[model samples]
Target: MKPAVLSGVHFITGDVACAEGALAAGCRFFGAYPITPATEIAEHIAGRLPEVGGTFIQMEDEIAAIASILGASSAGVKSMTATSGPGFSLMMENIGLAACTEIPCVIVDVQRAGPSTGLPTQGAQGDMMQARWGSHGDYKIIALSPISPQEIFYQTILAFNLSETYRVPVLIMTDEIIGHLSERVVIPDESEIKLVSRPRAKGRKDRFLPFEPGPNGVAPMAIAGEGYNIHVTGLTHNEKGYPDMTVECQKQMMARLTGKIQNNLDDIIKTEGYMLDDAEIIIISYGVSARTCHTAVDEARSQGIKAGLFRLITVWPFPEDQICRLAERAKALITVEINLGQIHLEVERCVKDKVPTYLVGHVGGTIITPERVIETIKEAT
Candidate 1:
């Protein structure tokens, strides 16, 4: 099949940009629900997928949405889904299932303010922790937070590549502001866009072990109906793809699941550092808040505060080593987010008294302004 790349620049919302990214990345199946701040993504892809001979299904709900994506992916198709906080919560069980069964799929959570349906249209980074631990268990996940329409486009493609490479559910954790905001996005040609396909199982079908890992701790997957002995279950299973309830089997299975991503941190973790070379106070932020933090850092620099900005593009692996290195050199660390102290705790953990850590955040329904971030920077100094 010909690649479905719209090779040009277009002014579009982040949600629309994301859909285009998925299409460019060769995502052939999208199973999603209509949820606020994220519905535009589903709407755009639903129209576009059919044009490329892809499938787009609006499931009855979020749970079924994710389940269907997993099914499609197991059939050797690149699949994805998009939702907001409530819908994301509903998909948690299946998210874990995707992780346990080693399925490749992307989940986009365009976050809105919420404990439970708190604000449908407002933006918040409250789901940072949930994106990491929402699914029950000790599996590792990859999550990217985008600050703009252009970035979300690239990040969505990256999300798919990572999911396929590691055989895990990757998340694009955008917010209402970024999702609804429109800007210029450059869509590269099919030849220019990098795509990663899942590693397919090779060797005799009769001798194939579905869950056996290679040197990288990632197993080559076999699609259903490929004539290989494929047995997939959420329960602990052996390399032969049969359930094994022994503690040793559980230990080995868990290690491969988590180790695949953790061992490849150099490739998976991405962050941007601004003016960090000669700064005493560092402001760490992600998503929409990072934009404000950048402005605040510039303002602080104008006032001779020696401040810097550390923006997280990949948030899930936590980027502990980089944060720790920055903490050791900087006098203080400030974490800015729309939610109250979710990523702040992570900063504090990394710092561990190496430097004082401060949180400049608030409850959702509104954004944290540059002035407020500047004020916190001054206070820290």
Candidate 2:
């Protein structure tokens, strides 16, 4: 059967549409502190949640905001939180806790100029690395970066699905430019979207092991106070979810935590390519910078330059294989971002010195222009 038509679609800011996407994905619990660019996400959800009989809490700070989302998720509710750079940093500890405890939740980071609140309301793509490893630990995280309001809507849903499927926090690494810019977004119907809930343990409900592995590597999550004596903590624990201090237990637990993401990377990774086949140079980017890069690629092609474009929809996991393949064919790899070359390093790492990579970046409130990217491509050519 064909999917049902989704009509009356219109564009809006990525932040506004992301909130709606969370609602459509059945997010009933929102705990967020207001921050620039991303504040509208919380504001939109705060208004929408009440109409759906859900709970929306403006916590004291980003720390408490993330903690509340974890608490809500443990109670078997689909929950999420949104923030900008500094708030994202504040939530890092609890985000690591969410990683350790395997809590399924979505974190929307509408990135802005950073490194100590550089520009609160302004745009920047400075937090790409932070989104991957900001939390203090040797753990893997799933991060998605959308290029448009339409993608923000769909990626928000994907974030929740991935979180639930793997029982780990998923970050929607949005940028301020896309977050604040309004565009037409066609909201898909609920029935058409594939929503996956965490598997619930059966039988021995009274003795359910919340950390026990299931078929999908995700353990069955029994809600707190749901008549299941489930134990949850941030410590390294055995299958019972208690703190374990032994070396073997710690290794195994860490393995499970990180392995869930690494083992299923193919399902969690997403990217977009344009004219990559037989192209000489491939410009890689994400967020709003990709918009500029796309135009640059077009102009370069018009100028008889064989330039391709690769946009990362899933930022984490880094699209290493795709990058390696494209890098082998291209003379140079140019990474375009709205900050001081965060993801450019990843591109370099993937190519492993096999390709020369150039960083095209900006700071403060400046947006990287298409002309600048075109010039960079011409120089490489």
Candidate 3:
């Protein structure tokens, strides 16, 4: 099988760049439902998947779309799906299954304003918390946010890599603005790109402990058709993957499911700090909200506010250590996003009143301007 490489520089939307990134990341299966702001990703990848020995399926709804990719990943293929808010909510049940079963798949959520389909084409950062805790029960997740088309392309590939390496579903938490924004993007040659494949189950098939935690706390997976005794179920299971409905069994299962991500925080978390070396006030933001923050920081500097930007390239796993340490020396923290205060809540929780934390956000629809961010920075000061 060949990997698709859309090499070189070209002007493209974030949606198209995401598709190319998935292809380049060795994602050979694309299963998705049509939803505005995110539909372009499916539309673009559908035409391209076939050209590189990949499969593209249009599922009836978000639930089926996610299930299809889960099945595809179990069959030893890199798989992914994209959806907006409502569809994202629809997939929560299955996303829990993916977490428990330890399936490797990428889920791109191109968010719009919504509790229930508020805006199809408009952008919002409301689902940051949902992407982390939408599903029932507790299982760790890795989520990435990109500020622009070029970064979205990179983040998508990184999402797949993280998913494969950790054998868990990774979320690409982008908003409609980044999804639809057209800009210059560069797709490097296949040789220049780095990709990660899941660790295939090794040793004798008969004695293989499918759910046994390895050194990294992640079990080596046995692909379905490869013939190892693979019992992939959401039920609390042992190393042998048999259903065990007892407290002891549930405890062990939860440890494996959540431990792998918790142990590798350094590897899974990514963030970019700008002008933070000596900054007194920090602007914490992610996705589209982080876009104008660069200008806001610059403008804050021009006015001598000593403000800096903390860009959450990776949102999930919370980066609490970094936030806490930054808060220790900083005078204030301003969380910026389209939502009223989803991520801001997390920021506040991390700071624990060490420094003042404020939110500069709205319900949704429009992008937050640099001037607004600067205003918030001023208020925080």
Candidate 4:
């Protein structure tokens, strides 16, 4: 019997769609602990993984959950895990380990309202900054935000592909609303979906250098027990994968770790612009907040305000170039998010006071209303 994919259009929550997307992306192992708003992802994968001859294990905690997935990926299996805010906090240290060791894995954080378990069932975009800089280091990571079930399905696959291609842990920074919202989703046929696998090391085992980057600045990985001596560690190391404690070694290691994502921003960044061609006022948003901006932009246009939307799909490389370009012509920019102006700071930095910028946001127990966004547009105009 084959693993059944409900291939046709069906109504499902974003978490379930995310699980199906991971399976389609060839994820063979799932290691996670149950958490609110994100539990559905693990539950779906737990039932389906076995059918596809894959593995699913519920770890004792979030720390163990991330650690298990890292070990599985080191053994050459495509792996993933799902969590909410608290669990995501626990996984930070190991997330850094994955970055340093150059492991390919996907970690999904279905964000909830919280500094510490504030609202387990409610949604928030508070984790936006944390997703990029939570792990206490000078490394770069790729993160994506999806507003609907269908988009999350597609983005999940893209997250896996990016993780494998860049040899870094990719994050899906969705919120509780999108994670639990039910909508029609279409799972593409396997032939139509593109998947990326990690590049393997070439040549004799003795000659292999695990940390030596290729022309693309990503080193080809060698799986454990694959006739290659692979040494992976969190400590700064040289090309041979041994611990090297020199200022020069630290500088070289850190540069490549950050450069792999920074230099390839063109490939890693994605955004969508609406009515931006001649707009004087632009609204910037991501995740569920972006959904409301669409309606707000339309309403603002009805009132003779040249309002536009700049929705972020790939949140992390920050879309600095696009934001900077938009600032030149737009009269003002308004950033709407669930948190208290987290991404607004980034928008301000990019604009550099070229255009007036304002933040319309809350502390996140509910969604931002389109009426408020439209009102902000009117005021800005």
Report lDDT (CA) for all predictions. 0.94, 0.87, 0.91, 0.93
Q: What value does the lDDT take at residue 243 in candidate 1?
A: 96
TM-score of each: 0.99, 0.96, 0.98, 0.99
lDDT of 3 by residue, 85-170 (tens): 99999999999999999999999999999989798889998898899999999998899999999998898889998998999999
How far does residue 306 in candidate 1 sit from its true spot (Å)? 0.8
**Residue-wise lDDT of candidate 1 within 230-306, one digit each (tens)?**
99999999999899999999999998999999899999999999998998999999999999998899999999999
Model 2, span 1-381: residue lDDT tens: 221223349768999989988987879899989999899999988977877878999999999999999999988899999999999999999989999989899999998897897888888888888888888878878999999999998898899988999988899988888899999899766677888888876777767787888876788888887787877888789988888899999998988887888778788898998888867888999988889988898999999999989999999877888898887788999999988888998898888888788888987476899999999898888
Cα distance off (Å), candidate 2, residue 182: 0.8
The clash count for each model shown is 0, 6, 0, 0
Candidate 3, residue 168: Cα displacement in angstroms equals 0.5
Error of 4 at 76 (Å): 0.7
- Backbone clash pairs for candidate 4 read none
